[model samples]
Target: MAAIDEQIEQVERRFGVQLPEDYRLFLRSRTGMSQFVPPADDYLMLDSADELIDINEAGEFQERFPGSLVIGGDGARELLTYDFRQSPPPLVLLDTAASDWSAAIPQAPSLTVFLDQFPETGWIWGGDSR
Candidate 1:
């Protein structure tokens, strides 16, 4: 189901950053995938507004990966995030096993591009392909 504006506001307040237009639009349209959705596992399953805060806070992402916010994951080690380290933050994949900057793989130039191309591009674990 679509997320309410208040939910999005809570996320913004928790993260202390204004989300990109594309991402906000996504939230307005659909908060995340439902359990009944296909491609249920090991895929980029987006987190709900509350889940976004809980997961990021639990992981201590700000201290560990400054300027980054965990948006979703593969239900395991791989995480989908927005790298706020750059202007107009790019979407990236982070490995939980590796705790360094090198572990990050640039997925797309922006959330807009990622959402637009994900169906065709899919996930790339080997290296950066965007």
Candidate 2:
């Protein structure tokens, strides 16, 4: 738990943005979750804080969407990210393959709401799953 907090702190420092409070709480509670397997073949799952930070720091994502933190993804192309630039922050789905930032879709208003919307099966392809 302490280690997770440390990792979260490190991410904030490196990214220059504070994570959503609910997300910070979530990380402190769980190490990681299973791969998201939504019905549409698209999926989303939480990543370890370390991997979360690493993905945000990666060249591909950085070159395309700066100031975005990759939290999870569809396991193949799309990415679920927290757009720090937005007030209150927003969870967005990025189309990685196309490298088209405009194609990004807003998923939730905040991390807490996003988690609540996750399916019982642990998948999140986007729907009224909550």
Candidate 3:
């Protein structure tokens, strides 16, 4: 697999925008979603649920899938995490799990697999972004 930075850069180049500083930092700090959990409003308020993803694995999502990351947070605070994205060849979802109470993505197979999604929000793990 490519280095995290390399993967991030690839996503940015393909998407045509620089991710937020905090987002970049988060990516640099993590390697995958193994350490992450669903966040509150991860499904209802953000534009791209993918936006709520850990920064570390963000690039991996981009590499696996190329379309925008929509995340909806508390009370209609919807926002687009990754805009205008796409997926790789022969789209498929990999290591993805979603249930009535949880959704976990070990690695995504394709971007299309993530549409119409909701994260296991209402609780979150990890330190403050502040």
Best TM-score among the predictions, by candidate number: 1
Tens-digit lDDT string for candidate 3 (70-107): 33222322122333333232111122222211122222
Using lDDT as the measure, the top candidate is: 1
What are the per-model C-alpha RMSD values against the true structure? 3.4, 3.6, 13.4
Q: Indicate the TM-score of model 3.
A: 0.32
Please state the error at residue 67 of candidate 2 in Å: 1.4
> Which residue segments of model 1 deviate by more than 4 Å?
1-3, 34-42
List model 1 lDDT by residue over 1-130, tens digit each: 3347787888788777888988887777776863323342235678876577778887556777888888887667888889887888888899876676678888898778876677666666777668
The lowest-lDDT stretch of 10 consecutive residues in candidate 2 is: 121-130
Candidate lDDT values, in order: 0.76, 0.74, 0.36
RMSD (Cα, Å) of candidate 3? 13.4
Candidate 2 has what TM-score?
0.81
Q: Give the TM-score of each candidate.
A: 0.83, 0.81, 0.32
- Clashes per prediction? 0, 0, 26
**Model 2: CA > 4 A from native:** 36-42, 120-130
